[model samples]
Target chain A: MLTQRLANIVFTILLLIACIWFAVIAQGFEASGLLASSGLPSKFFPQLLLAFTGLCAVIIAGLYLIKGQAGGDSGETVFANFAEARRGLLMMVVAVACYFVWKRFGFVPMAAVMGPLSLLAMGVKAISHYAIVLALTVLVYLVFTQLLNIQLT
Target chain B: MYGDLQALMTALTHLAQPVSLLLLVGGIVLGLVIGILPGLGPPIAIALALPFTFYLDTVPSLILLLGIYSAAIYGGSISAIAVGIPGTGAAIATVQDGHKMFKAGQGGEALGFSLTGSIIGGLFSVICLALISPLLAQLAAKFGPREYLAISVFGLVVVVRVAGKSLSKGLLMGGLGIFLTTWGLDELNGTERYTFGSYHLYEGLPLVPFLVGLFAMSEVMIGAERVLNKIEFSDSSLKVKLPGLRQLSRMKSVLLRSSIIGTIIGIIPGEGAAVGAFFAYSEAKRKSADPDKFGTGIPEGIVAPETANNATVGGALVPTLTLGVPGSPAAAVLLGALLIQGLAPGPRLFAERPDLMYSIFIGLFLINILMMFIGLIAIRFAAKLIMVPTSIILPTVMLLSFVGIYSVSNSFFNVGVLLGAGILGYVVRKLGYSIAPLSIGFVLGPILENALRQSMTIADGSIVEFFNTPIGLTIYAVLLLTICWDRITALLRRN
Candidate 1:
């Protein structure tokens, strides 16, 4: 299990790297035509925010490095147990997978698969749970397509 | 005054329409149902309904979203009292005393107090909103880029200060949120900063999808973790028995104080219903004759938080309506609805749409009044609603979010943005960062960037001129004073 202290420390470090990288990318930003000499460069706000975010990430990293915790978090593990962690991470995978499914296979196919896949990922054993989710998906479909006239495709 | 009366009449005419009345009732019922179900709060509730609003008229859309905002906060307490699990974050403070009272067989009475307090608090804040918003708008009419810069900075700083336990973490999230907003072409220069060759990125990340993803999709992921947890509560004590006038008279002081606290907290940027409820709860306990009895089943304990949380609905609208700044995450979603209607939210909105303003005030008042009848009937069925398993809800909400995001623009890229935002929200929350500042930061990002650049141009490279406005200086002064006062109070309490 990943503890919050270690996770946050690593997260902050990665965030710092992203901020610096973004800042470097920001330097390449240039305005064209008559707007080239604008009031402030387009990079100004993003770079300022990058600097602010980077400074905050550095402070958070230092706090975790020295105190083993930031705020009152007290270095607890991020997930309660293996089962809970698996369910959460698996659901995330299912969601991302369903999005790709929608992209490749269409909305109807994605809708059909999403609920049952989520149920499977959560390790749901109840057959009725899958039925209820499917029913609700149909309801969402009717409401959006028929009632609101939204094109699902 | 006559023009105001005319606007009120026009608003009444709009509300008198059958479609408006039906939606008003439907929104309340839907809000209660969603609120009774745990893990779905006001922001998600409003966001879910947002796509539907894309097809609605402005007044009806605003009315629907406002009803959800007000009732959802009130609805959370029902679960808190009956099931010991707060249906929303706002109801978390109510669980200690509310559930205790339910176990002690005073469930109906506790439910009554929360219902009455919520309506009263909601009505009071609506009154405050009606009175204060116009004056604020009048003052805001004089605001230039410098004043807006000050207000935006004030909003971001205040939200970050209250958002999380770690200031650095909050700041990091706020910065990240604002940075994400910088993805589209710059309005000032038309320079494509990070559009990455997509015209979809021209308008920046779509607001509604990002918001829905952050609040709803993220909740789906987190809620998936405990999908099998069952809720149990007795239905025997579910009936609501409202207090008599005499009993109500006795708690008027608590009700009044909590309404004030909630409304005041609601007007501040980034403070939400949860913060208001906890603040009112603590204040009520501190002033109680028997503070020790607070957590052990007391009516005052239930009344304070429920009232304050509902009051935040009206209070939150003050900034959202008058200043184009959202007072809460839920209000930020409401702001999106305003944008969808092609109406800019700010002092100009008040001047341009006096009838809409009147509609909001009158509609909120009516909703609070109607919530009583709706809440009374709804509480009887609260047990069943509470029992609807999370396993069923998580997948449905996830599907709804997916379908809802796709429906808004019929764009696959927007759906992608929604999924990405959900993952970001999930990671941040799991690692212990509140999404309030992040959501608010995202909403305020364009405003912040515009204000800063404009203020810089207006100041002509002089830093001192940026702080030259009297109103801007006063805002900064008040912000400094608030921080110092909080620190001093904390030190005194520690001592």
Candidate 2:
């Protein structure tokens, strides 16, 4: 089990690195010609935010490392158990897969695949649940294509 | 006054269309159904319905979303009373006494009190919105860049302070949300920051799709984890029984106080309905002659939280409509709807489209009145909705969100943004960060950037001049006072 204390510390450290990298990238931001005279550079706000975000991430990492928690969920795991984590992570994968399917194969194929695949990802074995999800997928298709006159493809 | 009356008349004419009327009825039913379901709150309800608004007229679209907003808050109470598990965060306070009464076979009466209290509180706040918005808009019209900077800072800082227990975590999320907004072309200058050579990045991330993903898709993924959780309820005694005139009159003071508390809390940016309900609940209990009886099947216990939660609808619209700042997460989604209508929300919105303003005011009032009748009928069907399995809901919501975001602009890039945002939201939420500040920060990002740059230009490197405006200074002072209020009170208590 991944505790929140361990997870947040790792997450914040990664976030701090990303912020620093983005702030460095902000230095190369350039405004063209007349736009250069604009009151502030394009990078100021983003850099400022990156700096602030980095500072907060540093503080949070310190709190978790030293104090063992960040106010809530003292010593609690990120997930209730391995099953919950697997289900959640699998759903995320299903979402990304659906997006790629829709983009490459088209809406109908994506729609046809998403529902049953999602149920499978969640380890659902109930046939009625699959039927209901497919029915909902078709209903969504009709609402968008027939009623709203949208070109789902 | 005469001009305002004529605008009101015109607004009524717009709202009287058959499409508008039908959507009003349809919106309430949908709102009630969605609100009855666990894991779907007002923000998701509004976001799910947002894509449909692309094809309708502005007034009808707004009416549909507003109907959802108002009824969704009221609908949460029905589940709170029927089952111990709250359907929305706002109903968490209601479960104490509401479900206890249900077990005692007084389910009908408990629901009746919540319904009536919700209506009274909703109507009261609508009246307040009508009275207060114009004055607030007028005052907001006098605001300059410095003032907007102050208010944006105030909104983001206050949201971070109040949203979650960890200030640093909230601030980190808020900064990340705003940082993402700076990806597109800079509005002040033409410099490209993070467009990555893509034409779709020219407009920055699309607001509607990003928002829909952040709320709807993230919820779907999170909900998938609890696919097998079962809920049981007996629908036999679910019929609502309205309170007698005597019972209503007896609780008038409680109703009035709760309404005021909810409205004031709602008017403050980021102090959402959940906060309002808890405040009103505690206040009612504190003021009660028999405080210990609050959670033991008491009507006042149900009325206080229900009334305050519903009242937050109107109270939230004040800041969202009059100031371009959203009062709550749901209101932030509503702001996206306003943007989709090609209307920039601010004080100028009132002057430019008085009919629209009048439409919102009158439409909300009508929604409250109509919800009472619709709620009576909707309660019988709410049990079925409550029993819906999370496994079924997760995939269905995910597909709807996918199709809905794609249909909004007919672009796959927007859908990609949707997926990316959903994953980000899911990971952050799993790690124990609230999304309120993130959403609010995204909405307020452009405003904050423009105000900061313009104020800097005006101040010309002088920090003192940047703080020169009286209105801006006053806003900062109030913000400072708000941040220190707890410590200030503690010191005074020691004295």
Candidate 3:
């Protein structure tokens, strides 16, 4: 069956791996010379937490294996078809692009593009929608900088 | 009695000052705006206001953040009624019937009922708070470190169970959240845990930045998903019609019952507002003479959840103010605000400042009174909020979050943390993990570790001594009973 449930299962598994990696890192954390004996050593809580987290992931994975309800086979996939999934993925790409644009060109310039780019991502082919969205961006910028007196660099 | 009178006078004099009043109203208005805005919830609202408190006195600052918190939860209902989408997670339960009413051309009526129910619920919880908080404070004053440890376990367990659909998911997230807080130098023995040689890591990850990112940034990602797939929708009517006194009086039982239900649910460590709302709603439905009339744009459907959910604000505050333990995610952030203000929550607060307690009690009352007017005015413009595109809203909120986290410490590392937290929150949320346990775990982790270490030191490594205290044992017993709550309910149903 072509379903998002498989993807969800993979997602949880990745998180489990991330937790184990954090635990390994925690174990390597070196304690300073004299102060290690003040309490139950600093690594106790972090390692305990990691073990619990690992146990949880294993149980969750087991549940998915047996019941198939863990990753949610609710038949609620937004990307049930190719076109919708493409548009949604494109929107994420646009948001990431806007982040980089802000990093490079600064807030005002990136903000100017974000509104229209998002509209384009959603397949809104209307000039009116773009105009309205652009106007909103300018309005928000003015309110933040002029009215609220926040310095937008 | 003489010491009590002196403390009370000090409190009264402190609250009588003019700045406190301004902060209260300003906080409410600010909270309303943040609550109305999607992806911006109480944690971000409070975190953004955290630095402003560094200059102001503790009382006014606490009042400001508290007002915002209570009002924001109430404000979330506005967007939930106006649009099919909930403004905050707490309003999620409201969506089942709230959006239904909106579709049937009763938007104005639905908004009115929600506003009225919210105010009533808020007022009821405030009254309960005035009566019960002092009593709890009195009882908690006798507790020691071991007692606190027991209470911490009770609180953490209660929250983990109530937080999500699966207990393992809650445990995993909660464990990971608590583990992350151990990243700085240990306060007790001065041993570094996971600081990685950075001086900025000296104080651990700053609560304000972490909270701002967790609530605000995660929202940006979720908002982006909706942005690409959003359906255009709007409500035409802008007028709200108030329910008559007779109608309100008729549902007084429902309002009272739901408020109590909300308060009790909220008092449980992590049941939170959304859970309280639906629980109250279902309870009302089951008790109703005509259950079939439910969810058909009826007044009862709207009233129960709104009343119960709003009541939760005051209910949630009870544990946070009494113990350092937060009753909900919003209250957890409020705890952070209190800590930033150099005010430690717990029994000392009651002994040192009962007047501050009175102020919160009275403040909740005033917030409820103000809500009647503010909610009515706000209902008219609710449609405008619905029309705001989630795409633009998402980016703007992300910008605000970035600017806000940067403004606090002027450090780029904080911004990186915000982004990291956002991505982490997005992944966990997508994988069906609740953020409440994580947020609550982060807040409670330090307290838990401190109490655990101190209790161990005090007991000289004796495991039996840890649970030897009578007070600690009682709390443990109560917690045990709480965990078996589902079985109790099942037995009650079968009987």
Candidate 2's DockQ is 0.87
Best by TM-score: 2
Docking class of 2: high
TM-score of 1: 0.98
**lDDT score, residue A130, model 3?**
81
lDDT of 3 by residue, B1-495 (tens): 124665567656666689887887888877777777665676667766765665578778877887788778877877777666677767776776777877888777777788889889989998887777778888888888898888877878888887777887788778877878888887876766667789888888877777766777676666555555554567575467778899899999899999999998887777788889889889989999998878766888889998998888889888898888898888888888788777899878877766777667766787788778876777666667656666556655655666555555657677777767777776677667778788888888898888887888888878898889999999999998888878999999999
lDDT of 1 at B278: 99
The digit string of per-residue lDDT tens for model 2 on B362-474 reads 89999999999999999988888888888998899999999888888899998999998898889899999999999999999999999999999999999999999999999
Candidate 3 shows a clash count of 0
DockQ of each: 0.87, 0.87, 0.37
TM-score of 3: 0.88
Residue B481 miss distance in model 1 (angstroms): 1.2
- Write candidate 2's Cα lDDT for A94-148 as tens digits: 9999899888899899999999989998989999999999999999999889988
How are the candidates ranked when ordered by TM-score, highest leading? 2, 1, 3
True contacts kept of each: 0.89, 0.90, 0.40
